[model samples]
Target: MTLERITLAGGCFWCLEAVYEHVRGVHRVESGYSNGAHPSPNYEQVCSGTTGHAEVVRLDFDPAVVSLRELLEVFFTIHDPTTLNRQGADVGTQYRSAIYWHTEAQRALAAEVIREANEHHGGRVVTELQPETNYHPAEAYHQHYYARHPDQGYCAFVVASKVDKFLASFKRLVK
Candidate 1:
């Protein structure tokens, strides 16, 4: 089966990574920084909001099992896309809602998803649909953070909440 890749930034990479890790048809999920000016930015630089980088997850999935549209649907369900440059208490450009589309078709689909989301909901969709660009992997400690540190304070409180929401909302998609 051919695999497709899409990178998204909805909030903390840890939150996104935790949710997607349980999603069926998601071959892999890697936490990283994307659309940044810096060539190889560390977590600190990205967090500083000076690198122009957003904390993103690069997903590898089999389209036959999980359509891009369905993936985006789950994405919207798990995060508050209406909030600009932030998710929950994480406030910064790195936590902004964004979709980095890898193809023209993906770009159109991303826009359609945003449109549908807005139409279905009462508020505006703050998620940005942008072309995919360079992606730099975050520090080693950040990858699979929630899984590795389930008992950690932030993982137990913040990341776990999002994971529960994802599992509850997308039961059919869960592995």
Candidate 2:
């Protein structure tokens, strides 16, 4: 099977990771830092907003199961791409909205989706579309955070809401 991947930063990686884990075509979603100047930057460094890294989820998926456009639709729908460097109260460059495309086809599709989403959101989409590098997976404790801590405050309030939105809107895409 031909697998395609994209990196997305929409607020906290935990939120995106939680929602993506439940999607039908997503094979893997790893939380990482990208588009940063520093190499091997840790969570604290990224959170400081000085590393230039965005907390991102790199997803591996099969196009036969779900098209890139469908994934982009979900990405744009679930998060407030209109916000710059913040989602809800989570503020910082690490929380920026960004799409890191892996291929030209992906890049083109992402731009198209962003334009459409911007139109729908009244032309205020602040989501950045860029070629990302310097990816470093978050510490193991961060992996599957929502699943492991469903009752936790952040997960219950923020992440679960996003997941509910995804599940409600994209019923056919749920696995």
Which candidate's TM-score is highest? 2
Candidate 2: C-alpha RMSD to true structure equals 0.7
Worst 10 residues of 1 by lDDT: 118-127
**Clashes in model 2: which pairs?**
none
lDDT of 2 by residue, 52-143 (tens): 99999999999999888888889888899999999999999999999998898889989999999999999999999998788999999999
Query: What TM-score, computed on C-alpha atoms, does each candidate reach?
Result: 0.97, 0.98
lDDT of 1 by residue, 1-175 (tens): 9999999999999999999999999999999999989999998889899999999999999999999999999998989989999999999999999999888999999999999998877767889889867789988899999999999999999999999998888899999
After superposition, the stretches of candidate 1 with alpha carbons farther than 4 Å from their true spots are none
Cand. 1 TM to true fold:
0.97
lDDT of each: 0.93, 0.93
Please state the error at residue 18 of candidate 2 in Å. Answer: 0.4
RMSD of each: 0.9, 0.7
